[model samples]
Target chain A: MSFREKIHWVTLVTMILAFGWYFLVYPWRIVASPAGVMATAGMLVPVTIAIIVAMTVATAFLAIRSPREVHAREDERDRNIHMRGTHFGYYPLVVGIWINIFLIFWGIGQAEQLNLMIATLVVAEIVRIGTQLYLYRRGY
Target chain B: MAKPPFTNDIRTLRFLAGEMTQGDLGDRVGVTRQTIAAIEQGKYSPSLEVAFRIARVFGKPLEAVFQWDDAGD
Candidate 1:
């Protein structure tokens, strides 16, 4: 596989694992103080730091293994695939933001609204990465 | 996967051109080897500029390299 493809797989895996741990295992509601709301959210600072470190290591390894491919320029096909994936990604982000706005109009709680916003952003990123992988495997 | 309406003779041309590797052709054409493979396998239709560039690499006209299949579409 190309270096970019390998990077895609690594990022996708890391994103899923990190987000999965936060959403599935981290206890968000344990600390309910207003000031601690974001701190106690599913995505804690420590988890974010861990993910950053993991990604840095993975990228370093990839660059070391294939320095030539890492520096290679992206060509027409790569640009086309990126454009297509971004087009698909845009729809989810717009829809998510619209839903978040509707929730605000409906007078949802502050914490719930924040949660929805975070979830929407995560889903949008998933859509972007998922679509890129699909286009890479299939054809543009 | 279903084949695209466009078909190319890249594999045969590469073979005739001193058994050019996919990577070599991709390098000349400014694309990834995977993209070259995809085009040869009839799974992808390259853009106009890329198609012209591939033809130029083989010293052939674009029509000689790629043919449109009206029936396939």
Candidate 2:
């Protein structure tokens, strides 16, 4: 696999694991309360930190293992795959935003809305990365 | 995925050119090794500039490297 493809795999697994933990252990019972928002904010700190650290470590390790490929620039195929991934990702982002807007007008709780937004972003990211990975595997 | 509408003889040319590695060819053509592999396998269609560059690397005319797959049509 290319260095970039390996990094994408790391990112995909990291996001899924980190967010999976967050959602599963989240205090969903308090999702309608102010404390729920605080909980979301509190939990996000560690999750963000974990993701950053994981990605940094993975990239460093991969670069060390393949010093030559580390300096390789993105080529035409990589750019094309990236554009296609972004094209697929945009759909979920737009849909999420529209849903969030409708929920706001419908009087959804702040924490609920916040969680929804977070889920939307997470899903969009997954779709984007997944699409890129697919293209990479397919040699596009 | 469906195959590209055209085909190429990169593998054969590479063999004739002292068994050039895909990585070497990719470096010469300013693309990735995987891109060259994909092009050889007909899984990807390279851009016009890239196609010309690949032909140039082999010292062959463009049509010698790649040919239209009239059978596909």
Q: Which number leads on DockQ?
A: 2
Off by over 4 Å in 2: none
Each candidate: what lDDT?
0.81, 0.93
Task: Indicate which candidate wins on TM-score.
Answer: 2
lDDT of 1 at A11: 77
- Taken in order, the candidates have interface RMSDs of 1.8, 1.1
Superposed model 1: Cα runs more than 4 Å off: A28-36
lDDT of 1 by residue, A56-107 (tens): 9999999999887887788777887778778888888899889989988997
lDDT of 2 by residue, A22-118 (tens): 9999999999999999999999999999999999999999999999999899999999999999999999999999999999999989999988999
Worst 10 residues of 2 chain B by lDDT: B1-10
TM-scores vs. true structure, each candidate: 0.90, 0.98
How accurate locally is residue A116 in candidate 1, as Cα lDDT from 0 to 100? 69
What's the residue-level lDDT of A40 in candidate 1?
45
